[model samples]
Target: MNDKENRSRSRNETSTRTGMGASRPSRRIVAGHTRPCAECGLVDWKLDDSRGEVSCNSCGLVVEENVIDPGAEWTNHANTGVDRSRVGAPITHTLADKGLNTSIAASDLTSGGASRNGISARSRREWRRRRVIDERSKTRQSKIRNRVKAFQYIRDRSQLPSSLKEEACRIYGMLSDEGFVTGRSIAGVTAACTYLVARKEGIPRQIPDLAEKFHVGEKELSRLIRGVSRRFNMHTITLPPQFFPKFVSDLELPPETMMALDGLWNTIEPHTDIWQGKKPMGVAAALIYKAAAEGGTRRTQSDICKVANVSEVTLRGLIKQIDGLLKSIGSPSA
Candidate 1:
């Protein structure tokens, strides 16, 4: 039988045994079918056939019947089980007991739902829906624009490189097959693909020029260029402008000291039969210093003696004669 019939029969049996007119069913009679009361064992009950409610007549507990509860799906629920029916009037009575207005919804008086948390669940759900809709709209618009742009690029294949042109032709074929004729710009597509292939082939092409020709942003063109360059293992040298001048200068000689004296000279004249025996060649270094002062060449006689590999006295005698010879030539001794 349905639950109502069974409950009615059970109430009748209880009233007959007690010899009372009251139709209250005990807890044991409706073990699995009815909900429990913590204060007493089904103290008093009223089952409404019209409304289908199991109510307590003693404490005025009126529970709605046939309500599916969330907790019942679990294997175990302590006290607050899912099968427990949601009652009417008890909520009103409870609020009344607390001297509160019973007409309002349970959420309204509870801190406007803000004192409990940041925001109400209803508002949060509405916000989430709006956000989802906005995101979806934006995504759809972006996709449509990109597709149009790509289509336009494919139509103008003649101006692009062979590889890029072929790709554009292929894309155009695809678009035709897909039944899309007036989507994007062919000129724009041709330039983009041409620039990309140039970068891939290690040829540097400026984006602004391409942008002017194809009606695309220079920034966008640059991004595409870098992407293609990286994919094709091509690298561009970015040396500073000043580095070239410095490199060329390094290869040229220093004209100021192009021929500087670097070796040492030592007089080692030995004894010879046809000449005087070996004698330590010596000269006053002061005389060589004085001769350099007279020559006015900014070089001291000591410097001359060093170059000639001779003593100071020999250097002075040679300097006097060299000075006269230089005068004969109308030039100062250097």
Candidate 2:
């Protein structure tokens, strides 16, 4: 009788300590999974997630305490459900300062903000002066000034997508810091990075177009392409087939034409001896023009040349080489 009374008292004390307010009347099922409790030889364990405790249901003995939770921290989360992420903005390499800048809004110095904060006219003028100095401090160094100039040119002048512009500026920043861009025109280096990034990522931008866009000399940018390739130890030759996807998209080739291009390259790949010294864009333009004609699209050579920025003679020369290759390979389609 005394042991039964003691057990009843223990259960009441444990229930009061847990304090799970109006959760549920039914017991949470935790039987047959864990070893029997030491106090009572029953596997009826009660888990209190609110208090992070596991206890024996019969004897009210705490079997485990302070259990760790792997989920997000519990607060008013269950009441008002929203994912409140505890993190800051992501870092990026597109800026001279790499996204660490904090700008003071000029509107904050307006009459409304001043009245709210009880700020005076003299205080606003003083903060404005401080903001100007802060802005100048970001470009105080010569190298920083150079990076700002190159990145600004990329943002304002280049036709690259926003993601590609980030990649191009990051490359320019790295090369400029490592002296690869030393004694080089800033515009030329920026253009070279943009072109190489486009080519490397299979975007197929023409060097002449990039030079005109970035306001740099074509020959100078081409020379630097070789140097940049050498610096990165990237010795792979850029072939004409790499240009097909972009050129085909520009000409709006059909699905059949895309497939024809695949088979066409397969026949041409075996005859590397013929197409080895050819201009890449010219060859790509000729092949695309031929494939489009075979697929019943019939894109004009002049239009293909204009899209590729290749002269008609260059396109014809590549087509003539393709003719000879087809003759030697005995391709019935050609």
Candidate 3:
């Protein structure tokens, strides 16, 4: 080629590559088309997912702005972030269908003005029929139907938190899978699982309380708990005496009464005779009553008994036992 033609071709190539007149090379480019920062001369660039920018990490300068983020847009406040995800509620074992089943609403279709594109009476009837069929289909399997009923009972009757409910449902499923539910009633197994989970999570619900709630005999429920514990190799731990302070506080006792209860627990905890084979709730109630009386809180025996759900007789018995122990230790009695 001629020298003039070669020079023109080189200039054209440089202009195309640099997007500018061929005066100098572009500073944004490096070896093999790598882009470096114009401010700090650094190759390291960070993509800000939140702000949608490519910024220089060292110089706090944005190398490129308005970058598109290929992630879900989310809003976070305080410690919680709202997941505006396309996916629905997470799969949970508590539901018979693991929460994947869709629901058909039976409310008035025209309630919302969007239903101005009205449906005929015949279509409405067909939808109602379809809703019935969907409902029936959910309980097509006997076991699944039983699980649904059991979950409803647990939720309505147990008054447990959702976390404990989910855990109980999981435990029931495990028991059913292991053939532990073959001869056991669904209610019994579910109640046992709920009690176990409450104890495991330290939520403070007692076996007798759950039994009374479910209308199952306390002896029967206790038997089921023991059986389930053995079958699942579950280790049940007794709630410590330290749990009494919360119970005392829940009784609406004053802070001084709570402090007095704490001191009483520390003094009497070494004496198991005072609480041996006794319900922790009863022991806690007795201690609270004693502490309140000592602190001049004017809480009556009947009042303490009602809050603890123990009889007045039991309360007096526990009080007497605690009072004796206090005297033996040379501590003044309430």
**What are the per-model C-alpha RMSD values against the true structure?**
35.5, 7.6, 7.8
lDDT of 3: 0.73
- lDDT (CA) per prediction: 0.42, 0.78, 0.73
List candidate 2 segments past 4 Å from native.
Answer: 1-85, 105-129, 156-163
Give residue 332's error in model 1 in angstroms: 36
Best-performing candidate as measured by TM-score: 3
Candidate 3, residues 1-334: lDDT per residue as tens digits? Answer: 4755754554445435444555654334312325645554445456766676767654667766767655664544354666544466679977877889898776753334225538676677777788889999889887778778887877787777888888888888877767787777777778898888877876667666778778788888889999998887776656336456566666676778767777888888888777868877788888887778788876888877776678888878888888888887898653
What local lDDT does model 1 show for residue 219?
68
- How would you encode candidate 1's per-residue C-alpha lDDT over 9-31 as one tens digit per residue? 55566445455734444443232
Q: Candidates' TM-scores?
A: 0.20, 0.70, 0.71
What is candidate 2's TM-score against the reference? 0.70
Q: Tell me the tens digit of each residue's lDDT in model 2 across 129-174.
A: 9888888988888899999899988888777888999998988888
Off by over 4 Å in 1: 1-151, 154-158, 167-192, 201-205, 231-334
lDDT of 2: 0.78
- Give each model's clash number: 6, 0, 0
Worst 10 residues of 1 by lDDT: 260-269
